[model samples]
Target chain A: MKEYTMVVLVKQVPDTQNLTGEAMKEDGTVNRSALPAIFNPEDLNALEMALQVREEYGGTVHVITMGPPSAVEVLKEAMYRGADRVYLLSDRKFAGSDTLATSFALKQAIQTKIPDFDIVFCGRQAIDGDTAQVGPQTAEKLDVPQLTYVESIQELGEKKIKVRKLIDNGTEIVETALPVLLTVTDTANEPRPFIAKKLLKYRKAACEFDLPKILPRYPQFKTKEELKNFLKKKGLFIEMWGLEDIKANKDDVGFAGSPTMVKKIESITLTGKGFKKIEPTDEGIAHFVAELIEDHTW
Target chain B: MASNGEVWVYAEHDWNKLQDIGIELLSKGRELADELGVKLASVIIGDKVTRHATILFEHGADKVYACEGSKLDNYDTAKYAKVLTDLTGQYKPQVVLFGASARGRDLAPRVASKLRVGLTADCTDLQIGDFKAPDGTEYKKILYQIRPAFGGNIIATIVNPNTRPQMATVREGVMPPPPSKKGKKGEIVKAIIKMQNLPNLTSILHREKTEKKVNLKASRIIVSGGYGVGSKENFAIIRNLASVLGAEVGASRAAVDAGFIEKDHQVGQTGTTVRPALYIACGISGSVQHRAGMDQSAKIVAINNDPEAPIFSIAHYGIIGDLNEVIPMLIEDIKKRRVE
Candidate 1:
């Protein structure tokens, strides 16, 4: 098998299950701190496909994420799930990025940090942004082919890969040239759980923000640089890059670069005229259908 | 007249027949164009699909740009994007709209990126408006792309003021189909696209319909269940209700994720968007994700034990009781009504 390099773009999103009324702030922005964050669900599916590719064909799986310092949580989680190397694209300037700016920053990171890649994987969309544009936009930025709503990999070849994509009512099998970007849907594959040994090894993995708090426990490593060197020697240093590290143009990143602006956010309330509640009895059931038929509901 | 400053809608077709969403978009484009003081045009691309341009006129398009070639039969993202991007550069439309179908979703972003413009996906609503950005800069004649986000708990109105030809993909079946004006005629401009210059990066190998066939998008009535349906076997009540009502069966993402039903039967943000004449929900809590798919239905009927379930909020008729009891009673009553 030919060795290939795969990069999976992941996002850490607020857990939708833990949503509360306080999830939205006064400014209509999501209150990220209120909700416990977890790895975006479909992104894990993308990660699994990348890992599967590595397992079938000899290669390395690297995970990349662009978010706040807390996003290292997904990077470490990626390491625990069999990624060989993880890079964190974190910078204060990269905040409030819409999908366009987010994709630009991610494309720069891929070009500068991991220049060569056989395949790029992304979840269909992030639960927070809910925009499935990043993967295709990145593919467009790199001038590569993109396969969205990918279901399964049919055949992997030296120059091309045949895969299945979901359409409106059917699935189409397509063969695309190498160096393609694929946005995997939830049906792509069931993400594998963290390996026990890998979990034990990567559980202690910490980025720069996490180092100071954890360094005090390891007295043997006196300085932050000493602890960093020790972690780097053990192949556990999480590669952290900022906007400057990736050579991203400042005007083209973060709030300044995003073209779409949120004019307003209104909480959804289903204000259908008050419904008529019916008793679960034979007479009531008959009246309900009669009302529906009279009202042209059917 | 040229397509410049015109409101353009990409009319997606599959070789022979035009997609329904294309007509729906033309209906919407007519309004948007009228409001923006621009002509409404439709761009039709496919192998031998120029014949369908007449339909565009009936749907309110003032002009139709038709491109035909064997290479345009099957959708190859890059090739389609290149031709569309070239047209966008030349025509310089103020706004571009597409159906939020699979093909549109794939093609819109690619074109948007190639043209370095903003494209909003799966917008539930589109309107012309003046918008003030967070930086306090005001923009005029912006396309307000409204969509449900964050599990559909809230609606976000997005605007792309900086990019020319502000683009958006609206969901199918949400908008009403236009009333066909049989005598309406439009000018047809044949676009000469060079197929040789396009890159063939991807080729379609095979196309197969999934064994589980459910056309929720076209269904007039839908019966959906959620996690409250309990077990995979317990979903029979839902199926039984659907059969009685002659409606399609639908499932909430929770039920689909729980293995109670196939993904094809799922209806939500990640699944299929549906607009039926009547939607009957049994034991569903109606998360915004599920509601996003079915809220456009003309009427909704919710049956669940929990009165506080969000499903009741939108339901035209609500029944607070066990679905096991309610479904059977409803089915029996419907059977009696047939005889009566």
Candidate 2:
């Protein structure tokens, strides 16, 4: 039996689409609470693909995300959909990292969370960064095979797999050896929604056992022991791990491991240039055709 | 401080015929190689690709390293990168170039990272060093890699300060194809391609291919509708024009937001990048995001009621009337022209 492990990279970004009048940030970075947080549409599609792969063949899907602790909201979504394990790399030290530094943190997490990597997948690009660099860069750091703009994955074999790259006209079918990385386009497939049973069971579950939301809802509890007892009774336990639990060096947890620095940020709007409509006369048509000819165009 | 002499071009295959961009890079590489006084080589890998190695001679490749074996059957980025990276270490080219297709987009970053070098993607132009009078032309021999930056607002000239081989990915149709001549020949170097058995990474048991693969990016003609198209029902008139012109139907971001069409047909920064031969805007106001997708089209025609719409900025032809009326008339005129 061949063992297959699929890892998907996800990110948390402000809901850029829901820019309303009530809350607006001049700097372009959103106010965290005012802006809705959702799993990236493309990353969700990537996870849907991974879960489907798991259903067809018996394997594990591991999701690794690097962000603030609030990002765990999406991890629970992944777990609800048959993920074998999930890991988060969250610390204030990783703040203000650009694409280059961001990729470094992800590479470190991929190594720490899963010792071995067979196939890694991610959305073509994130809505916020829009760089589309991290996936390919992560594959480079891992020194594995990569396929981008992937429209379909045809088959998976013992030592090799076949994939379809959406090219200019027709699809290009490729048969490559295993341990390949894929950065998928949204054209791949429609993502699946949450299951009714999984949603109900895992609603209040936490990995950190946060005492804020749960204890207050049930005010009858008098002591810390009773609250823990009720939480255990209600299945609100989370598998929380401290920094030491993951065996990461204290220095490497944040800004120290990052190597990229932001240069600047600018907001721009490009529109309304020149609009000159010429006559339907021969000279006017002749002038336009001549320019096209000079430019070697159709 | 390293060997800044060898110029490498990544090759492509179309219908068993070599991709024109591969030779285009070589032709451009010749100019750079001449200025730097270095050698120009190509990397070609495929099943039975060794037989086509002679194609490099027609161009200006001085050396061709062919990696042809059973393991080289398909393009696996891991295997391809390993082989290409090994060659880079051995040859130490001054620059490595590839077509900016999907493969190139993914491959260039990996190669650059492995070599710990810089890579400029979707480059539009290439020029060898500065002018010759020390500053006049010799500086250009440094291979000024030019690419569109700031979302195509400006073109930036990038160069690797201290890397063995500077790398770049160039878009298709950006440069002219290489011309064929009778007499140039190059040496073909053969290398062994080995593979390693790895674990089963991902099991994609079944992938149902999309029944309809309508890629608008490569289409020659695109007919795009906008908010001026009125209700979603009016989109039929726009579609009629497209059907007659044998073109793909597109939508401005506003049109997609209005539910006039699916997001896939939307042409803009958030949708798809398109550079067709001809673009027809049906009552569009031309938002910046919409213009970003079709600004590169060769010709544009706008039909709007406002007359003050921004889409007129790029339109080569204009009709200040309703699209419902204008589209039918244009379709009639095109039919007449074809019949005549």
lDDT of 1 by residue, B89-204 (tens): 88889899999888888889888878777788889899988887666777776789998877776798988888788999998877888899998899998887776755536999
The stretch of ten residues in a row with the least summed lDDT in candidate 1 chain B is: B192-201
Off by over 4 Å in 1: A17-33, A270-273, B1-4, B195-200
The CAPRI class of candidate 2 is incorrect
Candidate 2: residue A104 lDDT (0-100): 58
Candidate 1 C-alpha lDDT tens digits along A1-298:
6788999999999886545667756654446567778999999999999999888888989899999888899998998899999999999999988777888999999988888888999999888767788888899887778999998899899989899999866799999888889999988998998999999998888787778898997899889999998988887889889989999998888988787777888777644457888988888888888888897775
Quote the lDDT for B90 in model 2: 79
- Expressed as tens digits, the lDDT of each residue in A1-298 for candidate 2 is 6667889988876664444434335543234357577777788878877887778876788887777888888877876765666767676666655444556567666676675767788988776545566788777776565667776778878767788766533466666666777778788998888877777776766654366556666689865567776656665444433345445554433444332222223332333455546434444545544554477543
lDDT of each: 0.86, 0.68
Per-residue CA lDDT of candidate 2, range B1-340, in tens? Answer: 4355688888865445666668777777777677778888888876777666677777788888888776666555666776788888877788788887666766677766666555666666677654233123233345566754333333456555444577778766556456766677888888665556632222323333354455686688898899888878889988898898778999987888889888778886566667788888887887545665677777787878777676786777766776676666666655665676
lDDT of 1: 0.86
**Global CA lDDT computed for model 2:** 0.68
